[model samples]
Target chain A: MISIHNLTKQFGRLRALDGIEAEFSAGQSIALIGPNGSGKTTLLKCLLGMARPDNGTLQFEGSDLTRSDTYRARIGYMPQIGRYPDNMRIGQLFDMMRDLRGYPENVDEELLDEFGLKAMFDKPLRALSGGTRQKVSAALAFLFRPAVLILDEPTAGLDPLAAEVLKAKILRERNTDRVIIVTSHILSDLDEISTHVLYLMDGKLQFFKDIETLKTETGESRLGLAIANVMRRHANENQASA
Target chain B: MLAKYSSTAAATLPFTGEPDGVTCAEKKARPVAAMLKIAKYVLYDILRNRIVLGYAAFLFVAALTFFNLEGDGSKSLMSLLNIVLIVAPLVSVIFSTIHFYNSYEFIELLVAQPVSRRTILGAEYAGVGGALVAAFLFGIGLPVAVFAPDARGFTLLVVGVLLTLVFVSLAFLAAVLTRDKARGIGLALLLWFCFSILYDGLVLVLLFAFSDYPLEKPTLVLTFLNPVDLSRILMLLQLDVSALMGYTGAVFNEFLGSTLGVALAYGCLALWVLLPMIWAERVFRKKDL
Candidate 1:
């Protein structure tokens, strides 16, 4: 579980994350939805400690994440754009990660086998296609069997079958004591896996609700339509009030 | 509790194999072991790069040629000294600056890992610096050892190693100062030029203006300000050129004759390496990756 209190981040003139407050508990798969430049990625980066907050506290299980780095050991992150040493082989990258973590027992190589990644372990990362690289990132995220998984656009570059494979894995972990936060522009892709919805627009939290409640409230069963309905209602109210 | 994430029966579901007890010991070794591993990987990766490989080959060929042409051990040391004073530092600084720029993604990847900022930055410094040193050791050291086996050979080798470390540290400082690779590289080149060329020119101007006064001590202090000039002075001391036995030469010889002076010179070189590196590490720690 993670808790954030009034988090703020600024990049020169742009306020990337503006006093955002939220909490994420285990046993729920969260769909983080937002438009372009909505500060979704920035918020995720703050959670991973890649982007330091300008003001406020971010805590994991009652302890501040900024206080120490040991907290990251519990979270497996799949970056939106995976950038590795181009010269290194796929196998070596995995091997190096395993060496760094030294948690061989915790590594789940099921994705590697499922995606046929183990067969091309000898290939250099630079030489691999983008889809293959995404597979590598996905496999590494689940490799350590961490209690939390923070995936940014988890299936963005994957083929249909690969994307479906990842979605199934995510859904299977939905009822377990694991927190999976996924950010994706593809609403249909996330609807299958996400149980809870956290909508962000322009660095502010629009709402956080269970999937069924969100659908019922908006009179729309699909996530895409339900979210659009909320946005339209807010826009009309603002226009009429103005 | 453990089977909370599993879909299958608790007893049959496949997951992490190790029980919880063994992880405690593994966790303790994580930081140090991880840093060393990163450094090792970096070193190996750099040594294989075409540019570094070319640099090593260039050194070997140049050292071999100079030794063969000079024929005398002392003469070869003098020529090799000039080469090391300029080339070693230039290559180390430039290569490191470019390497850091090219590997921006690599740093991002590591930042997302379960490692501290201190560990990541520290490992980078160690990795790049150590690899450059190893390249110099084999590329230039082997030839110097073969050509000049005396104390002069060892002295030249030490100076070369120190110069490599100093400039590589400076490169890190340059890279950390700016986010833009072009600007960072420009800063690195500007720094290299100041120390390698402009510093000596300034020293000459000072010498000319103070020709009326005893400027030996001022000249010596000025030399310490630039690592390139300092290493050159170290080389001059090792060579002991008798033809330049003027007041300044006597001053240098008399001072360098003592053990304290040698230690002081080395301390200056060590400071050159440490100061920039410490500054870079501090900046890197606070940087938003």
Candidate 2:
């Protein structure tokens, strides 16, 4: 479980995360939804201990993640855009990452073969198409069976089939005492799997609640419409309070 | 229940094994493995990279041809050594600067991994230095080995490696300071040009301007601060060519050409390598990456 208290991060005059407090328990999947510059990425990095919070503490399973690296081995992160050495072959890159994490060489080669990457085994990453690169990124994220998986725009460049395959993978892992936090602009892609949604507005975590409750509260079946309705209500409430 | 459905779901997922097989402790921790993996790719990538190949080949052919046409074997050796000493550091600085700039994406990917920043920096330095040392060993080492065939040849190799480390350290300092690739490249090249050309020119101008006074000793003290000049003096002193190196070595000999003094000079050169590296690592530890 991840626990964040009074998390605040700022870059000069711009405050990215402002004294945010939240808890993410195991077996829970959260979809972080927000517009551009809403501090979604900043909050995720703080959880991963990749970014420093000026005025808060983040704890993973009662241990401080900021002070130690022990929590990292249990987590897997995939950035919005996967960056790799252009000179590395697909197979070589996977092997290297696997070795780094010290996971056994027994990776799920199903994705490698599904994408026909085996044929392009020796080809440098610079030659692969954007979709293929995303395939590699997705494979690396799920390969280790990490207890915590943090994916940023996990399906950005993927085709429908590959995207479905990745989403299915995230769902399967979440059922087995793992916590999955995904950030993406595509709400439908996450609709089936996201158990809870954390809405962010202007760098503030507006709310964290179950998806079913959100749908019932907003009276919308689709996640996109439900989110819009919630935002509209929040804006109206803010106006009344003001 | 989700338990029954979970098994069915697992089968359809990308990885189908039972999660029970591996716990976190069951897997070995190999932080350096990521770095080495990346380093291997860097080596193969740059080795096959046409631009690096062409640049190295051009330097080799140009150096050899110039030596062959312009002078005798000993004179050629001297000229070639001088050429590599001057050109090698600049090339190392430029090549490493470009490599670091170009690999920004890869750097980000590595950072996102459960890897330490130290391993990443170490691996990159090793990879870049390895590429350069390989080129130098072949480009300059082989020629000196065949021609000089003495302690001077071996010393030249050591000097080349030291020079490579120095520039690599400095380049890393530049790489860690800025995020803008163009600005980083510009600053790195400026550093190189300053060290290689402008600084020496400036020193010469100072010595010439202050010729009426005892500036030779003062200039020798100043030269010790630049690794290039120190390496050159060491090489010349090693070759017993101090006479040709002019009065700089005379002053250096008076001050540091003795056994203890040479040891101290080498110690100072080694410190130059360590100081920059230590600073780079400190900067990296606090960096946002």
Candidate 3:
């Protein structure tokens, strides 16, 4: 479980994440959605401790995120674009990650097998295509069977079939006692995987609601259409205020 | 079987289900070991790098050529000294800057892991610094030892090692200061140019501008400021080439020729290797990936 309160981050003149407050508990698959420069990535960076906040407290499992790195052991993160050492082989990369995580024996190799990555064990990371790299990122994110999984654009570069496989994997993981947070521009890809939709606009939290509630409130059956209606309403309100 | 057992074990745990069940104390004790693991991977990556290998090969061949050209061992050492002073630092700073920028995304990935920022940066420094030190040792130190195994030769090797480390630290500082790769590399090159070239010119202009003033103590202080110059002075003094350096050389000999002066010079060089790394680590800790 993660709790964020009044989180603020500034990049010179740009206030990337401003006064963000949210709570994510176990078994909740949150879809973090925002427009470009809406601070989605900044919030994720703050949660992961990659970027320090100007003001706020981030607590993981009731402990401050800044207190120690042991909290991160429970969080498995996959970057939007996975960049690995160019010279390292796929097997070596996985091995190195295992070694860093202290060689967890009960590793999840489902994604690895589903993506057929074991066959390309000797292939260097640089030689892999973007889709394959996405697969590797996906596999690594799930490898440790962590308590929390933060996946950024998990299905971006994946093919339709691979994306479906990943969506199915997310659905299966959702049944477990785990917390999953995902951010993607592809709303449809997140439609079935996410239970809650967290929308951000201009570094401000516009709404955080369950998908069913959002659908009912907006009177739209589809997640994408529902979000579009909300965004339109917000834009009209902003224009009227201006 | 192990996966099933671990899953059941995790479910039995009280509050949070840590699959691996790594305790807080175990986690705290693993930072050093984790840093070394990361360093090992980085070292392996760098070892397989064609450019670094080429750099090492270039030094080895160049040193061999110098020894072949100059039949006199000291003369060859002098030639190799120039190479070590200029080319070694240039290669080290540029290589380190480029490596840091290239590994930027990978570092972001690492940041999201359980390791602390301090461990990641320290591992990076150790990996890159260690690789370059190895390159210099095998490249230049090996040939020098083979040809001229004297005290002067050993001093050259020491100077080469220190300059490599100092430049690596400077390059890391430059890399952490700017997010852009081009700007970081440019800053690194500027640092190399300032210490290796411009600093000496500025010192010469100062010496000429105030020729009337007592300048020996000031010059000695100035020499400690640049690692490259300090190394050159150390090597030159060790070679006993003060006769060619005139009055200022004798003054340098009077000071640097003493035991305490040599110790102080080495101490300053060690500081050169440390201060920049510590400063860079501070910047990296608070840096936005």
Q: How accurate is candidate 2 locally (lDDT)?
A: 0.75
Which lDDT tens digits does candidate 2 get at residues A50-103?
676788888877766665443565677887777788777887887776666554
Assess each model's interface with DockQ, reporting 2 decimals per model.
0.42, 0.29, 0.46
DockQ of 1: 0.42
Off by over 4 Å in 1: A240-242, B1-30, B210-214, B242-246
lDDT for position B52 in model 1 = 74
Candidate 1: CAPRI quality band:
acceptable
Ranking by DockQ: 3, 1, 2
lDDT of 1 by residue, B1-289 (tens): 1211111111112223222343454544555566788898888778778777788888999899998898956787788888898899899999999998877877888887766777777778788888888888888899977778778888888989999999988999999999999999999989999999998898888889889999889877887788888788777888888337588777777776679988898899999999999999878877888
For each candidate in the order shown, give its overall lDDT on alpha carbons: 0.83, 0.75, 0.86
- Which parts of model 2 are misplaced by more than 4 Å? A49-55, A67-70, A103-106, A113-123, A216-222, B1-35, B55-74, B208-213, B239-241, B244-248
Please provide, for model 3 over B1-289, each residue's C-alpha lDDT reduced to its tens digit, 9 standing for 90 to 100: 1211121122123323243556555545566677788999889878877777888899999999998899646788899999999999999999999999988767877887777777888889889999999988999988888888889889999999999999999999999999999999999999999999999999999999999998988998999998998999999998777789888888899988899999999999999999999999889988888
Ranking by TM-score: 3, 1, 2
